[model samples]
Target chain A: MDIAILADAVERGERRAVARAITLVESARPEHRVQATELLETLARTGREAIRIGLSGTPGVGKSTFIESFGLMLVAQGLRVAVLAVDPSSKRTGGSILGDKTRMERLSRSPDAFIRPSPSQSHLGGVARRTREAVALCEAAGFDVVLIETVGVGQSETVVAELSDVFLLLLAPAGGDELQGVKRGIMEAADIILVNKADGDLKATAMRTCADYAGALRLLRRRPQDPDGFPKAMTVSALEISGLDRAWAEIRDLVDWRRAQGHWHARRAEQARHWFEEEVRQTLLAQLAQPKARSLMQSLSEQVADGQLTASRAAQDLFASLWPEMEQTKLPESLDATIDTP
Target chain B: MDIAILADAVERGERRAVARAITLVESARPEHRVQATELLETLARTGREAIRIGLSGTPGVGKSTFIESFGLMLVAQGLRVAVLAVDPSSKRTGGSILGDKTRMERLSRSPDAFIRPSPSQSHLGGVARRTREAVALCEAAGFDVVLIETVGVGQSETVVAELSDVFLLLLAPAGGDELQGVKRGIMEAADIILVNKADGDLKATAMRTCADYAGALRLLRRRPQDPDGFPKAMTVSALEISGLDRAWAEIRDLVDWRRAQGHWHARRAEQARHWFEEEVRQTLLAQLAQPKARSLMQSLSEQVADGQLTASRAAQDLFASLWPEMEQTKLPESLDATIDTP
Candidate 1:
């Protein structure tokens, strides 16, 4: 695990080195973490960049088929494609289904394509973090496009959206007015929504669903980051392989417009800062995760639940217990907590 | 200023003492906070309880009219009612409107009613926490009901839903199928969706909207907490005062059912624990809010944004810089962060 050698091979676009780099970043081992950071920092100096597109949909939404078609289209145009999945379901099931290469047989066999299954991650944050580093690795290895896929579930799409330049939401045909096709809270995060299975009998229904979402998107708050005519919906049949080119064109138009408006650089920088802040918060919380502190918190929670103590008082008690040396006046700092804008 | 006298007065349902206690809890001053905590602890021992109903709707959805008519109805039935508004907008606009007493002139003048304007707090968390304390004060003052109304905006409704016993979502009519009448994610948080303005020529439209949401809610996964026919949609008109009694009956049915199932106590305990955990997290964040630590974070954020360091490495560097005495291996505890179930 020579960091310099691995980084150099990754920079040279060697397949084995790229695979090994992703594995290193995904490792939870402390020694592997040290090497992974060094490797990422070394690769960062290479100054390579990629189009990071985040894709999400419900469980049976043909995500794999769409990715296969889209990845093959990009590969045909001489663009190197990398696909990564952020599925938190693996943490609960002890299994991974998304990003399965076997599901996208055609794209998996392409020389210009690289597909990795979702890591059996234990949480949304950990999975998203590893996938983000893998995206950086792909960029260093000269990939032109990195498609980050997240299964539509609790908070996963939103987390993946933070690391993407553009986000696509895939859907099946929605019923008239029910519009209950997609999960709640996700429409706001999607820049482009594609209604899949649009061929044959479902074609007309898909068209109607597209129009319905298009109308809903128009009524929702318009994001300042998007160019005009964006956050729109369109029909795409992955089975028919129709509309893929149009979707790609719209994606390019969006990326180009954001780049021209200076939003492209600003967004990535903001996302990086967001991750940094999240990591910082996690570090701070780790102190309370200690065994003694956790047991104390559990007892306090039970007492507060049983009405023996108020929530605010329980928090104050925990603070006192954790740090008896600190002054009583400092125990409840949130009473005077003030936000400082940066 | 005298805790014993004030607690006694509040327990006796004295108006002046109740108002004074709320102001004390809402104060950001360190001294007032100490007194507020002491007063709350004393009030807790009294064991007075009130039904907490959280109401949310888009502005101009006739929330003021509805609360006025509903509060008057309850007062006419020999029940005291307290109305509190949680408005984060006041933090930005420097103007309070939601809970203005004048908006519900009739109810405000009634001796059996209490109306408090939204506090001009600086952020969502602080505003909600203060409102929770105020609700406690009202309960101690012998109010039979506490109506917590939050203007439908951003994440305010969801936070209020956490504190509510039975959550109500007030929506206006929708078009044939747009369903864009309410906020995106707030629907699932609702236990009841009341189609307001169901009186005029718009009455037919409101009925249709109610049916649409009824279908949508059916499609949503049932919360194990709710019994049959719950999380349902109904049409109500505060202007006509026609549906007030029916809405009241439905609310009572749901509350009674939940109590019979033991969800009432469980829900309250869960809410208290939630607030306790939130307070602890805020306390942890306060440490990083120190001037020196803030400056360090800003520098690290800037470096990560500029791509001078990866987000993870920057977090590692911050940990090392913050605690030079601590072992490097011990600093990145989140690498092994595990969710410990209680």
Candidate 2:
């Protein structure tokens, strides 16, 4: 229950203890999260200097192969690598499959590599939050490089980008025409684009696709952080492992470029702000689900649906009806001011 | 301003005026929606019997063409038809570059057929509340065979199914492994599968794809309703306007089967319940974004992020803090009680 003790253990490079500490933070138990948060604060104070990179692509895109080759390169350079590969389907029933440990078989067996496959909970955003926390845990456990992999579909890219310093979007060399399938909003968010499976029959198509992407990148605005960082589209074969060195080199170049321009810290700070807002939104929404509040909403909804009243007027009535209960405790001034405001 | 007056105009078959009125309902303005909903409710009472069918497919699957051809067929039968097509990109930014009106050039010119295209909105739910209201308007306007065409990607299929009695999934014969890309969850939800573009070089592939889908359907559980109704997969050429009659016939047969078993009304009732829940969720979420509440959430978030608190405890604190004001309004206990059960 003592988070400070866990923090101490995590700071001492105790791997098992660090993982356990993260598990505690992720625990739904009220008491455990409180203690884990305190431990997180302690870890934050130590200032973990890990290079967190995010990798995402469509399924069967050889994400595991790429990560394995890239991670091995990091180990070869005398750096400890930690991979947090998120399997969105693994936890369809609210349980962790821990399949990343199996999928990244070679990486998991490596002494320098720590691979954690996080469960995608009922909320994908929750999975992202817990993964971010685990990243911090990995840093406290002495890993210098952290790679987070996510599913290519839906809002996973945005979620992964929230916790990463450098975001890399992986693509297949399905030809330039297939690029239309990628939503522009998601494409705009990527810092790097990799054309994977570039060898064999895909080689010519990969080159062409990469060229098309490079051209498309010009139509988009340059990233705010790295004015010099052009979105680079490169071809690589994860199976052959030919471009691992170049990929790692480019990533480091990007990190250095971002750090030199002060964009690295600025982005992290922005991410922290984003994390704060999402956390508040989720927490408050959950609170709204409390029995009494939910019942109030349901009845108000029926009244609105039955044409007896307007939604805004019903909201006003509910607030009026529940005013006494709301006024009981003196909330923090910031919160109080917000609630008090019309 | 009088909804009853608008309903009267709609019932008199004022097409342009009714179209404009439906547009107003889909508007974000509170007053507009209030007026629009009132107009829709009045129309709901005197609704005509419309063969409401839902059509959903991936982009470039010729959804507009299918609707146009289908609408023309109904018009040939001396029946008026209404086509409501939803374009997602148009909804988000309130703009449409690829005009569906222009795409359905012939249908737009039809005196007995009405075509209305709605843009997708910021709401995650594909069909807007106003879209439902517009359906009622079309019914009041004396249009039979209301065909709702929804974009292929995302959860739009489920949203479209709520407003229509029959749901159809359109597919392109995509290579030998055509079914591979069709997600299983979505396939399970479809009532009918129609392979479009089934002509020229694609005819053989389309037939094969239809056979594959039929085989797949056999392995799945029989639809809860219509035990006698076979889930048929057909090949059609929306462009050539061939096999559409057969598709329509099958649809009518399914609808008739559902009605005979009394599943049609039950499905609509369930949809009504879903609409109620969705409306409540949207309303409550909007309320939380009120200027004051947002600021409070922001402040609370920072404190939580700083490890001064856990999210669960913070939520409890927020609710406990707001209790007095909520209690003062003297709302019924049923609000909270109802929420607890759903």
Candidate 3:
């Protein structure tokens, strides 16, 4: 119940306490939000100097396997690692498997690694909200690095891009034709492109795929002020733990380059702005769903559907009947007078 | 210009006049909206009866080519066809090619077919809005079939699905693994999936791809209420018009089956409800962007970004600052008491 004490424990690098803090923040209770805010503030003061990385791609691209290998490598280097894996929950239910632990069993057992899988609440905003908060919690727990992984479904990639310093898009070894099938916008957003499952028979095809991707990358308008110097293609076998060190080296170099260009700070600031706007949009939607407003809107909708009234007219009527009255009661005399004077 | 006069002309099967009327509705002027409402009122009284079809797929999926051959085939069937193609627009300038006429050159010259291409506006709502209104206008012009072509992308498919009776998805044959990679959500939403460009050297590959897709379709959960039975996979060469007749036959069957099962009316009713919700959401977003609220919110955001205030506290402050206090020249206590009681 005492969030301050729990937050202090989390800030002191007590692993179990940090996990507990994350759960409290993730709780939907109003009281939990108050407690979560306190925890975040405390954590913000003493969070780790971790390099946060985001990994995203189409589903079944072996993201879990890659994260597992990458996290194990970091642990082998005598560094602490944190993995925040997000999975979108079924809309009918507010829960998910939270299954990243099962995929990263070895790394999950390591003393220096922490793996947390958070359910992506129905909307993109919900997922982004918790992930950012969880990252802060992990950092506060003194993890040397944070890896956030999400498959390229819905707006998950965009959410991950906003929260992390580096974003890696894991592509399968499909050729140019298949690559062209994907929306260019998603491809353009990637900081690095890693062709996954590049071992065994997929090796030759993977190299060809990499070449095709590299060629396609050239045709794309160079990213504006790209901090990664130049985007490079790499073949990696997450299943075999091969070519990962090179991938890690490339990620570090890109981060340092971005930091030098001040892009790292700039991106975080942009992310904050995006979060602000998204919160406003979401909260406004929630407010509109309040009982009185919702019932009236639904009734009018039924009428509109039955051809009793047109849609635009119904909207205007709702505005005239409800909102105008609310506005009249809301404005102070001084404010009204100021408007008249103007 | 009198919209009622325009509507009357369109109702009388005046094609040029109907096109002009739609242009007016799509205009960004207050007077145009007033005219559009008058036109809609007149058209609504005419008892709309038209088969509205939605076609969507990723770019380079030969959408235009398919529509061209399909529309021409419908024309030959003694049906008047109207094509509404929504193309992507440049965000900076709001300029677009409106190139369907060029792509569907044969259809453009056909006496029984009408082709209109509109720029997809910056707002997805704008695209949905204009497309629906245009369909209504085309119906008023005595077009029996309205084919709406939308660029396949996030949320666009959902938008297209809401406005049409029959939905078709065009897919490319990526390779042997193509069936495995395609998103099941899109496939499920489709009433028919057409493997386009299934001729020339691509013929053998196309047949194989079709078989794979057909096999994959079996694995998906069947819609319990598909009156035309389950969704089917078909291969067509949009350029050569091969299998054009079969695709049209399938489309016609689905539309008739939907009408017989009363699915048509229910779909329209559901669409109207969705449209109503979308309008309210947009209105709330606009209200937040109003000068007073925007300024207050901006100030609060700066504080939150600087870490001088918690987000929750900043929100309360913004809400308080934006709401006008209205304790003006007092109403008579009797009236005030009466109003308060209500």
Best by lDDT: 1
Could you give the interface RMSD of each candidate, to one decimal? 9.2, 13.4, 15.4
lDDT of 1 by residue, A160-207 (tens): 889899999999886875676565568888999999999999999999
lDDT (10s digit) by residue, model 3, range B236-340: 998898988988888878877877888778888888778767766665566665667778778777766665654555554554555433211111111111000
Kindly list the per-residue Cα lDDT of model 3 for residues A177-199, writing each as its tens digit: 68765556667777778998999
C-alpha lDDT (0 to 100) for residue B70 of candidate 1? 90
How much lDDT does candidate 2 score?
0.69
Across B50-118, the per-residue lDDT of candidate 2 in tens digits comes to: 878888888878777888787787788898888887655554332442376677778778888888866
Report each candidate's C-alpha RMSD, comma-separated, in the order given.
5.5, 9.6, 9.6
Per-candidate TM equals 0.85, 0.65, 0.71
Q: Which ten residues in a row have the lowest lDDT in candidate 2 chain B?
A: B333-342
Q: Candidate 3: lDDT over CA atoms?
A: 0.72
User: Which scores greater on TM-score, model 1 or model 2?
Assistant: 1
Judging by DockQ against the true structure, name the best candidate: 1
Candidate that beats the other on TM-score, 2 or 3, i.e. the better one:
3
Candidate 1 lDDT by residue in tens digits, B1-342: 578888998888877677778877877666776778888999998788899999998877899999999999999999999998887776532244433877899998999998888765544267667888999999999999999999966667877898789899988887964685565568888999999999989899999999999988998888977889989999999999978899889889989999999998889989998988887777666667666668999999999999999988998888787755333332232334221111
